[model samples]
Target chain A: MDFKLKIWRQKNRDDRGRFVDYEVKNVSPDASFLEMLDILNVDLVKRGEEPVAFDHDCREGICGSCGLVVNGRSHGPGRGIATCELRMRGFKGGETIVAEPWRAKSFPILKDLIVDRTALDRIIAAGGYISSKTGAVPEANSIQVPKPAAEEAMDAASCIGCGACVAACPNSSAMLFVAAKVSHLALLPQGKVERKERVLKMIEQMDKEGFGNCSNNYACEAECPKKISVTHIARLNREFILAEIS
Target chain B: MNKFTALYRSSVGKKIIMSLSGLFLCTFLVVHVVINLFLFKQDGGETYNRYSEFMSSNPFIRTIEIVLFAGLIAHVISGTLVWLKNRASRPVAYEMYQLKDNTTFTSRTPMLTASASLVGFFLVIHLRTFWVPNRFWETAPQSNYDLVAAAFSDPVYSLFYIVALVFLAFHLRHGFQSGFQTLGLSDKQYKWLIDSVAVIFWLFIPLMFAAMPAYFLWFK
Candidate 1:
């Protein structure tokens, strides 16, 4: 399949970026979006022209490395998958695909489709962990976690910190991402020890990073590659309230 | 004092204030709507004026008026501050974006907040026409329902009301569910229940209020 791609291009972090259009002929319909970009880069290299730059690691949806806003929808119009998982067949042949980096005050664009997502890492570093030292792996049953709570924790844990929630949010809010991290740890027995402080500290870090507040737009939930529920956000709010009051 | 300052200073803390004040104001809207319903009685202005009189005179109601104004001020200030911070979060706008693909009308439209600002303007006008004069400034500002009937007699006056009520409806549509979500009261399990209740606030309340103006203009 042939496709026209309008990709954001910047020489470096200092260069003002602009959309540069490129056409790839005779591309495989089943190639993943990143793989299609690989094909385009190969062509650009052969022609001695600069190639588009984007972040990708595993080429799978799980690494949270691949981030792109394809045709205005984060993660390329597909529900519950990242840009790397998007297939060329989803678009009609000869269609134009617009790809851009995540735009937020915290996640500054490095070049092309790459954004600095270290702000998310800082939020995790703030208090997104169980502080107790565990020298050995404890017995799973000894923790006494209920099945429902365990499942919910795992659900929240599925968030990959891809920055799509912030990208999709009209306000550029990282609330959903922070909510996922907060809920993931808050629901477990091991995490309950620092629940109050964890929420307070992580939220303070999130605010300090300058992400916007959630307006209940639910775009973050919708564009989430993991399809993390916004209910976790409500839990985050509840935890923050409990933490603040105490 | 440190904790108190932190509560209002943080983003999440400000939102907590916004939700509480917003929900409190929603309750006031309900009471106001119910009192307006008395206007539908065939006894003319008698029943409406009676409730209005009690609302203006009762010591409890009078005392709560201070709290009501406080809540309004908190809601407006926190909301505006939050909005300014949110705008700053996105310094560079997306060159090409379609939020409509992912979000619902009320959810996506920044217009919802704009509508709320218009509703705020209408609130000032409403108080000037009714509340302040009837209660404080005037020696005799025509009896409540009679004054309302007289105001609605003007086509432009009633039309302005209908327009403002439209904005109020749009504001409440997003406000009710958004408040619940912010307060951590709406979860996946009970989101439908909250949304269902929101229909009464967003739908029933504004429609009932709009009906008053329409009744005075067309039916009465």
Candidate 2:
């Protein structure tokens, strides 16, 4: 298969970016989207041209390091899979695929397809952690978490912190990401010590980061690579309200 | 900032105000629809006129009107601010923006503010026609029913009413559950019920309101 790619190219964060057209020929249908990009970069290098720059760590979707809005979708055509998981088979032969970096005020474009996502890390740093002193590895069963609560917490814990939610959101809201972090800890017994303070500080950080507010669009959940639920956002709302009242 | 100021300044705080004001307006819609139903009584607007007279003349109802006005102002102002801020958050636009899965027309559009603005325009004409005349202008039409009936008799006015109600319905459809969501009432347990009620409220109330003009213009 072959694809005509219109990829956003930026020399650096300070450079004004523009879309550059490139062609990848003899691409394997089984190749992941990132692998196809790698083939294109190899071609560009052989031609003595600057290769397109994109971020990737684990080709597997878990690291949340790889992201590009392929043909106007966050992690490409399919939900619940990162860009590294998307296959070339998803597109037709000789199709023109447009790839761009995540567009958000908080997430600035650093290069061709990589945007700085440290704003998310800052939000997590604000309060996405439990602060228990680590003396030894404690027995997991001592806290006695209920089955349902544990399951719910684990579900919320699945967010990979990719900014797809922000990119896909019409408002560029990071509510889903923040909500996942807030709910994962709020639902667990181990995280209850600073639950009130956790939600408050995290939300304050989220606001300060210049992310938009959730307008109940549900695009975040729809486009989430991890398929995180918007219900977590509702739970976050509940937690914030409870924190305020308390 | 103090907690109160912080709450008022935050996005969530503005949303809470919108929710509360929207819920109040939703309640007012129910009452408005109920009273408007008196139009279909077939008493040549006698029953409807009497109800309107009592509602307009009652001191308690008048005070509630003030509250209703305040709620409208708050909902509109806060919603506008949130919309502007949300727009500003994304300084850049996607070249090929596509709606992802589960996104509805109502969800993507500025249905609340846009429809509210349309409804607000209709409200101005409605007030000039019915409210202003009925309240302050002593020499205006004696019966509220006659005024409404005459207005609906004009095809353009009736069509405008019907169209305005449709926009109001779209606004309410999104607004109802959104209000509850902002208030933290959209829990796993009650979300189904709240969504069901919202569907019914948006559909049923607007249909009922639209039926009044339909009845006066065509059915009668």
Candidate 3:
């Protein structure tokens, strides 16, 4: 496959960015999207040009690092699939693909396609965990958490904190991300200990980080690579209410 | 803190005021419609005049009037704040928005139409005839029927009021459910039902109100 690419390029966080065009010829349809980008980067480096910088680790789609707004959809045209997992065969030959970083006030660009997603990590660090005692492991059967509750917690815990939700949301809201972390922890007996403080602290942290409010648009779920449910958001709302009331 | 500041401080704090104010306005609309329905009664003169006098003179109703005015101000302002926030968040406009794919027209149009109707020229006329005389001037104007009939007698006035009511219906359709959601009255099962009922009632009722004025102007 031969493809034309219009990719966003910025020298630094301070520089105003614009789309720069490139063409890659003789690309394999079986190659992943990132693999094609790798081919382009290799060609650029061979020609003594600065390579396009994008974050990626564990391209198996677990690390949640490789993400870009491809053709106005986050993580590319495929539903519930990351950019790393998206194969080049999805596109036709001689196609022009537009790629850009997630345009958001909170996720500032560090370089071309590389955004500082430390804000998401900060939200997690605020209170995305249970305060378990640092000691020898307790007997697993001691707590005896209900199977349904454990299953629900595991489901909510699947969030990889990719910031795709923020990218997809028209409001640029981080509600899904915040809600996922909150819901996962709030459902467990271990998490129930700090439920009140966790919700209050995390919400305060989220607000302090300059993320926007949820518009209930559900675009996040549509674009999420993990297909994380919006039920997490409802659970977060419930937690926020209970925290405030108690 | 002041009344406005007190209402703006917290999430629950803001929404509690919004719900109370919205519910009050909802009550006001129902009562207003009921009073207007009296005009359709056989003894239009006596019923309209007596209802008007009862509304004006009753001490509890007078207290409720003061609160209603406050509620209107609070609801509009808080709702506007939410609207502005929602608008600011979505700074980029789509090529075209299809409501069916995303949200209801009632959900999107209220803050928009309400803002327009609140500030528009016809609303000024509405205030001059209904609000200003009733509230500030302390004038015992003609019967409510006469006032409504006179306003609707002009085709332009009738059209404008009908348009405003259409907007109001759009406002109420979403307002009812949004109010319930914000007030934490929404549960998973009942939530969709509440939203559906809100859409039906507001859409139907406002059309009914508009029809009365439209009928009197065109036919009577």
Native contacts recovered, each model:
0.78, 0.55, 0.08
The alpha-carbon lDDT assigned to residue A145 of candidate 3 equals 87
Against the native chain B, what TM-score does each candidate's chain B reach?
Answer: 0.96, 0.94, 0.80
In candidate 2, position B15 carries an lDDT of 85
lDDT of 3 at A214: 55
Q: In model 1, which runs have C-alpha deviations exceeding 4 angstroms?
A: none
Candidate 1 at residue B46, lDDT? 96
Candidate 3 lDDT, A1-246, residue by residue in tens: 999999889999999887899999888899988999999999999999999999899998888998888877778877778889889999999999888887677788899999888989888899988777848888899888889778878877878878888877766778788888887888888888898888767776766666665545467777888888777776776676677666
Q: List per-prediction Cα lDDT, in the order shown.
A: 0.90, 0.88, 0.74
TM-score of each: 0.98, 0.97, 0.84
Please give, for residues B1-220, the per-residue lDDT of candidate 2 as tens digits: 7887777787887888888998998899888889989888878889898899899989999999999999999988988888888988888788767864658766665665678789889989988998899889968646888888888999999999999999988888878887887777787788889988897688999899889888878876
Computed on C-alphas against the true complex, the DockQ of each candidate is 0.81, 0.69, 0.24
Task: Note the clash tally of each candidate.
Answer: 0, 0, 0
**lDDT-best of 2 and 3:** 2
Could you give the candidate ranking by lDDT, starting with the highest?
A: 1, 2, 3
* Weakest ten-residue segment in model 2 chain A by summed lDDT: A133-142
lDDT of 3 by residue, B1-220 (tens): 6644533544334555676798778778778777777766767557876887788879999999899878878876765565555455434332222223334555544454553455345547777887666666655567666777777889987887888787777667666765665554665678779867776557766777788778779877
Tens-place lDDT per residue, model 1, A158-244, is 999999999999888999999998899989988999999999999899999999998887999999999999999999999998888
Classified by CAPRI criteria, candidate 3 counts as acceptable
